[model samples]
Target: MTASVLDCISLSYQPLWGKARSLTGLALFVQPLAEPPVPGPIDARALLETIGETLPADGPPLFVVPQSKALLLDTLAAVEPPPAPGAPGPRFATRGAATPTVVVPSFLLQDDSLVATGVRLGRDRGLKLVWQGSADAPPADDIRDGFHRYWLDLPPPWAAAALKDATRKAAVGQQIGPGRLPPGHIYGGIESRVLMEYCLDRCKALALAGWPGEDVVYSLRHQAMQPSHAVVMATLKAVESDRSAETVERILSEDPLLVYRFLVYANSPALGLRNPIESVRHGMMMLGIETIRTWLGQQVPYASREPALRPVNAQLVLRARLMDRLLDAGIEEALRREVSLCGLFSGLDLLLNEPLGVLLPRLRLSRRVQDATIMRTGPYGPSLEVALALESSDPSGVQALCAAHEMEPGRVNRALLDVLSEVDPDGPTI
Candidate 1:
């Protein structure tokens, strides 16, 4: 079969988490590396036939967003409702044959003709139509019965919060129940545990499109490691067992908090170092395995036992690895490792409760890494930007960055997937 347009494109994604941070689906953004020279819109055939091929059959549902109306219509046309039970179908079809959820941009709602056609296609084909707009964004003046069937986007940012807050106040006044959600609302970009609880527990939203891990980790600030420090304890054992610097760094860096602490301790006045520690490798060498072992021993008793911390730390480390993958592989091993550190420490600001400029400069990172991480400039800036773009999982943002940097989108997407596929010694990938 001829390759679909997906072959020349880079796809960025956000794993949509439902209540309790459960994996609901993966939202894949389509970005074309090279624009079509022909006078036509992009194709959506590949979204079904090509892009979906890259994902696991049994994995979460795939949410594919296309840039053009033609592609949107085409996608709706391509997917047919599942066959009736006992009907003829491919062998193992039920095992890994998850169809993608087609996302129709809010702009499409503006055109009555297009919206009508899209709704018809969706209903006829039995495709899941997710309207990417406010929960109330369906046409108000000329409401169509079919519009109600479309899955709504997360309520406009703050819209839900505003309503929820108002309801809370009203409930306090009249003693009414708190939930005000329209049944079956789909929320995205949720970043709060409080809001998550309201939506999931009270309003009972169908699914949420965000992760509250960062807030969970932030609440853990100034707290010692909990009992979940088993991983940390194991790494300390590695150091005690005379493990190589490489092995220890690999084990220790798995915990973002530990990595940050190591750098802080290594650069502390107690160490009396004129120059700052550059990498985990350097920190381990300067401090010596014995001292490092002893420091870790002190931490294990109080290390974080929070399970939520695992995924957060995993994501930070993966972002770092993705940045390293974005770098030219033929580059010197040392420089490559330095670039990876920039990625690793990209989240340092979140961990340390201080801006990266304040935290990183004290460590005396190389000017290039400093520029890339803090200033988003110099040689390594592009990789860091791309890494962030992927993290944000915005297709247009990824497209804009790739175009600005003259970087290939396909290569960047591949790099992200590659890093995500890597095996983590400490635990599961996020």
Candidate 2:
């Protein structure tokens, strides 16, 4: 397509993809690269490194695929045994958290086709593949073909025929839910309101039809954010309210993806470190609930919501975490947890271009989490507001907001830097 044509299209196109297409159009206008899809081998290591680089400090969970050829042994060795038939899975080594991985069984098999691998990962992660393979090289068309075939094979009894028809109906503004949803869609914006509503409707529909809600939530998060964050959110939410450690352990035993990410992040300089966290369980034990919650909040990627929005989440999270630390404010750890959650999802609906009310149900978040996310008039809402204001680089506005709490902008700024340093001592200082 011509640059002008692409420009006329929504900016929702992946930035990297848009840039690639723009360059390709220019190149084709001049002289074409000998290859069509610009073929090359997928570099797993390089892709991981780039993901690690692109990751935001206070973003959503990072979904990482191992080097296509990398062994799962590194992550699997530590997995606890699955639970007995009726028992809870192994508790995340932490009190209230899992080790932070989402295991996708089929990803074990890899092939020369990038698309095939991507489909497997997406199915395993329960998300739509966003940045499939790596950015270092382009895939052969074989990859894309294989991916479609695999995806077509992954869905349950809902035949590809049925699912395709349903998707088409949804696209044309047909009755998609138990109730009418506002017109906004993912192709439009990146606010939390838009995303939550879209997901909720889909989840409700699945539940109404007696299907598992996991797949629907996964698709929403993927379409709204990226596969990594989407899967993390879906996986974590899938844990039953009364779930025990045994149940968690069982899930982890088979989920290598979650294990790898947990260990990687646990040891990553991004989490601030004097040494590498050696195991998922060990990391969970050492990180504690508050720290783990913070990490999860950061890992929830909303990058695809809007290009301009990518950094906004990071800034808000940085500010919220900093404020929590500065006042040593005698605030409950749970409140800090709320702050982190609010910061991450505050713009979810906007990013996905859906309504908050429509999507909140899919998350199955506590009334507290839901209240904070929607009303912004609740306990955690004020902090979210402050975090967002500061994200715009408006120190004065932040100061004004904190005035009631007897806090100062300078103090908030310094504390935020300190918190950022503490969270990622060895990674980027900011």
Candidate 3:
């Protein structure tokens, strides 16, 4: 055996977040071998013996053995089963149910490969094959230390770069996993961070490609909440190839906050509507497609902080909303939706204490909004002049955009006063 030769495989696991309290239910990460061992023919007996010997002597530890696909199947076959009825198996499971099995991946698996074998066994025996390094359940501290030590022990530079690159790649891929959004606040842990970054990248790419803002916003919502990258990629491709409103609505329905906001905007007086649009689809229909796209662009800041400078934030959202409503050529529903969304999200910078780019995704906004936040660098940046101009009591900027649009600034001013009256009868409209 050479330096590349395995002394024995050890259990290693990394969670997306949180500390592991026990080893029983957690999936184990198989620490990587320091060197690439020779590709010799698979040997089941030798591998099992090596694993058993390497199992930690003390302090509850699970053995996570990695071997060639052939050897793993052979070893599983040779392993002892039921300790006779009324006896317990080494792992826990309900009566007649298969024990849980974890399958951690360092790289993409080959089809019909080693992992596939384990998956087949899991399905047949009713075992659960969980990916260990998930965002929801972080690795235990002790386990993380063990893996870090093992990684550090490897040869310098090359080993370090490889580990870093692998983690980044894994994080990028993990943006879309096949799991449901953890219940409660939609995001706040490891998963949210990865998804936010992924959404940002997508927004950047779309902006560079000159994709429409509405399309981009819709895409982010579809991808950000999904469980896996494969799904996100598939949905993105579908939407891009065919800009379908129905698909976008289905994705938006997943988040309650988004739904409520949409409904509220759909029914607002800004829409000048006699009746409310009750359903998401009906609301979408009542609001023209282009305007809805604009709304999506503004949705990213839904979770933004309620600005400390309440008046300032209000003016920001208000100005942007007014611009959207005034400039829009769509139906009342669409214009109202766009203006309200812009108003709601425009003051995000004041609240988040960061640039719009840094704060937008935290709002879990659609891709369109992300683009407007980042790439709309021109004078017409969606929330740019409007937000700033609102602060100027003179309202010169508002006068300018209104002049450019050939609309009377008085009507717009009246609209502002109207909204302010509703917001606070005692407060003066500056």
Candidate 4:
């Protein structure tokens, strides 16, 4: 698609959390240029194709929830599943590998036209239909059997109170009756940790549709963030093969905690280095490839085995990469790399368990990086802010941020898509 199409739309992703807080997939939200730009009701098939190109072949399943009937039909028709493994074709095409899931709101099932023939088409095409509804409403019996899984919304506060005030009210804890919300349906719109836990732990919900932003888990800030052993091993491999410092540094960026630890180790008095090692590239150079390899080896066992944290680090890395991309191409590579770090460490306080004001000082990072991460100022600050706004899929917020900085929204969009499109998952392509 042309750049104009991309400019007319904005994309935001919400991670889906499954068992053990593992990231199961992403909910791709597409907003068609509204003023403030909340994810719009219906997205075009072109938008899906555009997004599909960016996702890795092996990335987690993607769920698209369309808010309009025509759009839903068009969306389903736009993609064809991969012709089995050995079929005649490229291994993976964006449309074929889009994998067949379209989250249909419960209300949509009421359409007489849909139940009549649409259900048949879904089955014929190998589509996986998922039902989305609230605690008080569900699909009618006629269309209920078509969906593979259901996405149920918890009872609203008023509804719970109303149910409690009824003559034959649901007793405490029975407000979400199986009759309305069958067990095993994924919980949708999980905005907080409490809701996420109740659905995954207390209720029998199979998975969650959205993450409770990290702010909700502020208490976990002090808990040590774990680095994926897989990533650590990758860094070690790169170093052992005598890859350029840039290559090793890119691998290190995949896991911020590992990068932090590396910087800390490089700065240790044991090294007796004359200079500070603030960035991963700098650390690799000062510490030497052999020293880095030995250190990474020692870290393999200490790495985290939890499946959940992989996406956490991946998302952070993407933001940093986007920040770097948003800068003018003419800018020197060193400044660009430094700005990327500003985005990378922006949230280190949460992972590192100390305020950046205090934590960043110990690392002795450059003033610009510190200012952007801590004070949210400096030349790097605008790009970081824009990157964050883009995450929300609020086109207006992104536009405003760009305008304020005299940056172009088109460039921001290009930068974001470029970073996201290039994602290479740690696991095999699905």
Task: Give TM-scores for every candidate, taking all chains together and pairing residue i with residue i.
Answer: 0.75, 0.31, 0.26, 0.73
Model 2 residue 404 distance off true place after TM-score fit, in angstroms: 4.2
Better of 1 and 3 by lDDT: 1
Model 2 per-residue lDDT tens digits across residues 1-430: 3222111111000111011111000000001112213234333233222223333333322222222222222222232333446877453233222222222223343443443554444434433222222212333454333221111111233233334433544547566653232121111111232222332344221101011213333344545344233334533443434345444332332222333345556766666766545444456667765565555555555413232222323333444454355444677654554455455455556444567776554443457656767887666656566655543312345545666655443344444434433333121111
Please, what are the lDDT tens digits per residue for candidate 4 over residues 68-176? 4665666666655445667663322454444636777666567557543575577577666787778667776766666788877766773354333332446687764
> Tens digit of lDDT per residue, candidate 1, span 33-52?
45633335556554455444
Candidate 1, overall lDDT?
0.66
- The most accurate candidate by TM-score is 1
| Model 3 stretches with alpha carbons more than 4 Å out | 1-313, 332-335, 362-368, 375-384, 404-411, 425-430
lDDT of 3 by residue, 104-210 (tens): 33232244455555545543553333322323333344223212111111124433443343335335546533222221111111112233233223211110001
In each prediction, how many residue pairs overlap at the backbone (N, C-alpha, C within less than 3 A)? Answer: 7, 44, 18, 2
Runs of candidate 2 with Cα error greater than 4 angstroms are: 1-224, 229-323, 326-329, 422-430
Given candidate 3, what's the lDDT at residue 117? 52
RMSD of each: 5.3, 21.1, 24.9, 6.6
- Predictions in order: lDDT: 0.66, 0.36, 0.37, 0.66
